[model samples]
Target: MATVRLLTMLPLWWSLCVSSALTPVRLRTLPLWWSLYISNALTPQALLAEWQAARIKSLDVDASRYHAQVLFVDDDNARARMAESCADALAHWADAGWWIYPHSCSLTEDQALIENPRQEAILTSLGFDGTRVTAAGAALAKEDLDAYDLVICADAAVRDAVLALGEESYETSVRLLADFATVADARSRALFDGLDVALAERARSRQDGGELVVEGADAQSDRDGFDALLESTLVLTAALVVFLKDSFDASFTDSFNGLLRTHFYDERHVDARWADAEPALRRHIVTGALDPRERERLFDAHMTGLRQRLSGDGVSS
Candidate 1:
């Protein structure tokens, strides 16, 4: 009887071993659980393997990303499509990211990519899992510009427009984006249009305020700033997607090395080129302020904080 019982247990052990290998699991967590079972053998090892796999899978689905919002300033329907494609490809991931495309970011109403079935399907396939899809652009209440680490522009037209908007107009644009939050009507398209109008007005203000002032030689600077803001914004926004997908776990930092590069800050791009000439452009950002001196001081404080951080990173002074 004793010999027969021992022999039967051999099959039970073999079954457990096979099950552990067959189940889908993360590469890292598998070993620890496998070892526990291999050593303890008190409970089923396969169950432990399954649990670890589930935990890791959850990380991919949720992570807190910063500045995942992207503002794509486009000009026409074709441009919107192109921008959407690029935004989808860049933003679509395990953790959904945003590419806030405002129709008014373009030149006219028809310029927006409002309806595209195939593109939507493609984005869906990529897991564009964003919870909200607002047609209105982001309304950042209060110039609260410092809250965002990056701002991306799809075109030079966008930068010119942003600079053109007056302070009140810019504030209204952000409000319009907020309006989308409450839009529960069939006329979502119309509500979205209202938001576009706000953005268009803001762009016009940026230009009229002399914020977008330029000459023959400095024309490239405007383009550079626009591009830089976009790339930096994409990177920042994508980082947020990555972070949120991982549920804000600091250990999920494996993605940074692949993207943290100089191409984003290089003058070959719009951001880099514009940053190189910030002294001249700085005035434009504070154009509507009551006290330019105080604003400049505040801006300086912000710059100091950024510069100190950059210096610590071994970046060139």
Candidate 2:
């Protein structure tokens, strides 16, 4: 199916996570809130409410509304419980008639399923899950994120997993600065590192915010910031592809291109118009927790198209 996966990156250990480990960061919720607040677009709470509404709105009263199974990619047992509570917050979207599969990420074999062992400390310390919440039973599977219509992650961890699974440079999507305030040359570094220039300037513009005030980059606005994001992603992916193609031989090039087409071009199963079929970018920097089965399906379809093309078939443009 043409999937619109929106994942969260709550587990910072996955990649370039600057959000305080002490603070509870969620890809689908808090991190998005922070991104919007810093971007000067909406308050954290507003950002959350808006995205929830947009997602719900994406589905309607019609029983046939193509509901997206919202996935949450979190790890911390405490964080997982909190994310699930937001399930009630999902009443609106569910009433809209969409199916949501709340998901979280864990190592493929981490035997620790801490759903609510020590919730008070994590919950109180992070300021999330204001109401004490407990964890659910062991999740179906780490890779289950693919089973849904959409994936909502909570932090860079989730996004990194997406890039890693799809072979996308997932880290670049959320790599800003280790510490925005102390990073003496964040913008200069960004120029060299290929991070967003405007996002860098936003850091510079915030004179007193320091780490606390550095906004937007981490905030979540599932509706907006994605344009620049996808453009950045395409640039990076294209550059990587070109670099490999130039350095590698014809066989290697063919293999790599086949992979690219599978993820980006093959899937048109989403219930959106062509214009929205394959988004160039998205405002939300969500992640896909683990590789999805559709990953192979996409690549398989790509290979099929290539065969047809060689046979003097397949539509062009």
Candidate 3:
């Protein structure tokens, strides 16, 4: 009798597993019986494997596919590493058919693979493989610029270097990474428009407001400066992902944005605050009054609210 009952529940159990894998929130809120069954029948590694497999299968079926190559160029390669690492973590760019290449405009051939310990640590903490970071063999050449579907520069200086290679055609394909965030929407534009002022204020507070230096005199100060830079890079890369995903499929942008938002902000209560007091939050963002930590928190909240609103419109994350 017990064997027969177990056999009868197998189909239902499989269905639940599939459903939970596709929508991970369901796994968290499973009933007592389901939870017990999962614990007894599957190890943690096995469950994770199941979930990953399900996710891959679902992604395979997505009609809105992307197949593009992207190159990230920067002076020391730190920005390029952060851009690729953050994009991989937040957007699953590899699975989405994005080929991301990182290059350094200043490093020589011998120094191409040298890693920045601080930047590597940050990427590793964010669940990316720091070993994967690499610099191009040579400086930014016209041939290199022409190879990629899009060439993203860390700043105006890097952009100018690529432009100096004397190819008018490079103008259309190459762009500043921050430009994506600024033009993404009203909120993003407002936040980024004030970013320079905010960064300047931060530098002045540290008593080193010249040339936007990220290094400091001491170890702790150095870490703090790098942390601020990393946060800025991650957020900017996220904005670029938003723009690309929206362009991939205008019809499903809401769903894609919801998924992106959940990756950035997972707190339900925080999402509620943004939904409740958007105008007040927008004011702070526009004025650059919020410090780096505060700015990240509010931005996460606002993006999370965007997810909720889109989900309410029948789009699932």
- The 0-to-1 C-alpha lDDT of every candidate, in the order given, reads 0.33, 0.33, 0.49
Candidate 3, which segments miss by more than 4 Å at Cα? 1-65, 93-114, 134-138, 184-221, 250-317
RMSD, every candidate, angstroms: 23.9, 20.5, 24.6
lDDT digits (tens) for residues 164-265 of candidate 2: 654532232222111111222332222222223553344234322322211112113321332232222222222222222222233333443444454444
lDDT of 1 by residue, 1-317 (tens): 00001112234675566556445563245587775554454244334334323332432221233223333344433223333333443344322333222122343455454443443443344333222222332332223322322233333344344445434233222211111111212222221222224432443333233122111111133444433222222232333233333333332232221122312333233223324434544444222221445434434544454455666776644
- List residue ranges in candidate 1 displaced over 4 A: 1-69, 77-110, 130-149, 166-317
Give all TM-scores, in the order shown: 0.24, 0.29, 0.44
In the range 1-317, model 3's lDDT, one tens digit per residue, is 00001112134677566456545465568887887676655643344335433432232112233434667777665666666665555455323334233333432344344447655654565556555543333455567766666777776666677778746556667666654433333332232322234542442332222222221122234666575565555555655555555444442433333434544454343344434544444442222322445444545655666678768877664
Q: Which 10-residue window of candidate 2 scores lowest in summed lDDT?
A: 210-219
Q: Indicate the TM-score of model 2.
A: 0.29
Task: Write the number of the candidate with greater TM-score, choosing between 1 and 2.
Answer: 2
Candidate 1 residue-wise lDDT at 161: 48
Candidate 2 vs candidate 3: which has greater TM-score?
A: 3
What is the lDDT for 96 in model 1? 38
Supply the TM-score for candidate 1. 0.24
Candidate 2 Cα RMSD after full superposition onto the native fold (Å): 20.5
